[model samples]
Target: MSYYNGKRVLITGAGSGIGALMARELASRGAEVIVTARRIEAARKVSREIRKQGGRAIPMLLDVSDLDSIPAFRDRLHDKAGPVDILINNAGVVFGGEFEKVGLAEHLNTLQINTMGLVAMSHAFMDDLLQATRGHLVNICSASAFVALPYGSTYAASKWAVLGFSESLRLEMKERGVDNVAVTTVCPSYIDTGMFEGVRNPLFTPMLSPQKVVRSILRATKHGEALVQEPMIVRSLDLLKGALPRPVWDEVSLRTGVASSMKSWKGKH
Candidate 1:
């Protein structure tokens, strides 16, 4: 049997891209999937497709950025699906541009959805997760979290916060005797998802597919792995950043085009 068989998995931002893909992947693995997105119709479409494929799934409206929506979302979940055994914080937005070029609202909204929303959802679901005999929290961070990304500054910062928060929460959960729950943080290089549509992949670092990322996530969750850095190149770059001096690393990044990969970004506007 698949490790995910019979597990109840809740994925945020399942309307499209990585979130929707994760929902489909988990359902295919025999998990009962709850697909939530800000848009009700979008969520419903994904849920319906999963059901048509003989997988268990339900759609729900969950706007993580709205604090007022969470309590009601929680109540609805409790009334419908009980506690989820796995929570995938996969909903995020990316706005790629130089710091000064982007509006302040864009930066703040990035934090609100990518950082604050993740935090709020985790807090709202923590108790239900604790109630499970075994629970997993999967956070979708990015390779950008590992280093400074010039053009994608705000998005990178939000991911950095997520990486830090995921690690800290993992340790806290362990120390609190919540051994049954595991936290996994995933940091993958540029994914081919439309979110980064025109962004260039740095030299030797290709864009990953959503399927590849979802597979890595499931493997990590099943084995209780703490961190997942995909494509090997991402890991190598992270190591290089740690070993090299700051200026040297920056120069290397510049030469490799890592520092300016987003120069051509035409992300979801």
Candidate 2:
């Protein structure tokens, strides 16, 4: 028996990639998955497959970037999925390029969808988590949150923001003595999700498979872990960055291929 069994999990951007994979994985574990995406068809496709496989699933349309409509999205949830027991803020976008080459609008859109949208979802569904017998919040961040991603600045910034917010929320729950709901922030390296199509892998950090990352997420969420920083290198980020002086860290980043990893990035626009 898994902790996800019977849990009503809501996953954003579950049209494809890691989001869709997570939806399927959770549903197979006996979870009642709510697969949401901006494109209704995408959501329906995933839902249909889950149902075909004898898993519980509900497909819904959700544009997390449209902060105003999030309330309405939550309201609609009451009619179909009901109050969610697990909220996975997996929707995100990327405009990978040199700092100045990426348009201002693209950079801002990255933050809007990746950071603001995530915050809005967390706010809108928070009450449901509070009321659930066992609730969980999962935020799919990135290894860039801890290190530098030169060509993907906004993407990194958004993940960094998510990391901070997730940590704060987790601590706040602890302070409030709210043990029913737990927060888990997942930070994985460059995933082979086609999002980073042209990016070079950092030394010793091979591109991760979506399935592997999703499995780790489920395990961490089930165990109520605070964070999931993967690839072993990620686990040592804080120590490496914090212990080294500014100039020394800069040199280390460059020498380790982390700084140049995104120099040639051609991600999904």
Candidate 3:
């Protein structure tokens, strides 16, 4: 039997891209997936596709950035799907440009969706997760969390916050002796999800496929791994960042094109 055979999984931003892919993947593994997006039609489309493929899925509307909507959404999900065993915080937004070129509201919205939304969803479902015999919290962060990203400052900052929050929450759960609930933070380099549409991939750090990332996330969740950094090169750079001086790391980032990857970014966000 599939490891996810009886699991109840909830994924935000399931309308498209990574979130949608994760929902489909988990459902194929026998999970009962709650596919949610800010747009109900989009979520329904994904859920319908899963059902067509003989997987179980339910569509729901969820705007993670709207704090007031969270409780009602959570309640509805509980009433329909029972307690969630896996919560995937995958909803996020990114606007890439020079700090001055990006509007203030856009930057703030990036934080709202990427950071605050993740926090709100986690807070709302944490109790249910704790009650589950086996629960997992998966946060889709980015490699930018490990370093400064020029031209993508606000987006990077939001991911950095997510990484910190995930790590801290993991440690807190451990300290509190809550071993049943595990936290997994996925930090991958650029994904080919059109979200980073015109961004250049750094040398040796090619854009990752959503399938690869989803597989890694499931593997991490099963093994109770604390972190998942993909493409090997990302892990190397993260290690180098901690050991090198700020100026040295900055030079490396620039030389490797990491600092300027977003120069031509015309993403969908």
Candidate 4:
């Protein structure tokens, strides 16, 4: 039987992009997918598509940034969706530009959606995960979590925070002997999603297609992997950055175009 068969999966930001793709794929694998997005129509559209493909999916409205609404949302899920075995925190937003040049609200919104939202969803659904026979928490972090991203400062900052929070939670779960639950953090280079429409590809790191990233995420999730960072170049990022002296690493980042990769970002999608 497929590992995903009979699983109950909930994916945030399933209106489009990789989130929607993952939802459809998982449903096709025999999981009952709860597709969520801030826009009700968007979520329903994905759910409709999944059902048309003979997959099981239901649409729900969610805005992770609005913490106050989470409890109520959880209550609604308890009543209808029951326990979610896999929770994929895929909802995120990015605003890229010079730090001070971008409005403070834009920067704050990025953190609210990308960081706070993930934290809030995890906290709300963790218990449901624990009660399940085998549970998984998939957080859609970013490669920026392992390195600096100039001109896209807050986006990097938000992902860096996710990396820290997710690792901490994973360790905490282990410390508490909660072996039934698995926490996986995904860190991928710039995806071809419109959210990063104009980001320059860093040397040796070509832009990734949404399909490629989604496939990797699902493959890793099935095995309860702790981390899923892609592109051959990204796998060694932390090691290279940590092994090299500060000055040398900075120089490497500059030479590799990492330092200025986002200088041309013209996206808010």
Q: Against the true structure, what is each candidate's TM-score?
A: 0.97, 0.98, 0.98, 0.98
Q: What is the lDDT of residue 9 in candidate 1?
A: 92
Q: Which of candidates 1 and 2 reaches a greater lDDT?
A: 2
Model 4 lDDT per residue over 186-250, tens place? 99998987888888888999999999999999999998899999898888999998899999999
Superposed by TM-score, candidate 3 places the C-alpha of residue 203 at a distance from the truth, in angstroms, of 1.7
lDDT of 1: 0.90
Which runs in model 1 stand beyond 4 Å of their true positions?
A: none
Q: What would the per-residue lDDT of candidate 1 be over residues 1-269, giving only the tens digit for each residue?
A: 99889999999999999899889988999999999999999999999999999999989998888966887888899899888899999889988887888999999999999999999888988887888888999998998899788888999999999999999999999899889999999999888788998987889888888889888888888999998998887778768988999999989989999888988899876
* Residue lDDT tens for model 2, 13-44: 99999999999999999999999999999999
Ranking of models by lDDT: 4, 3, 2, 1
Cα RMSD for predicted model 4: 0.9
- Report lDDT (CA) for all predictions: 0.90, 0.92, 0.93, 0.93
| CA deviation > 4 Å runs, candidate 2 | none
Q: What is the C-alpha RMSD of each candidate to the true structure, in Å?
A: 1.1, 0.9, 0.9, 0.9
Q: How far is candidate 1 from the true structure (C-alpha RMSD, Å)?
A: 1.1
Which portions of model 3 show Cα errors greater than 4 Å? none
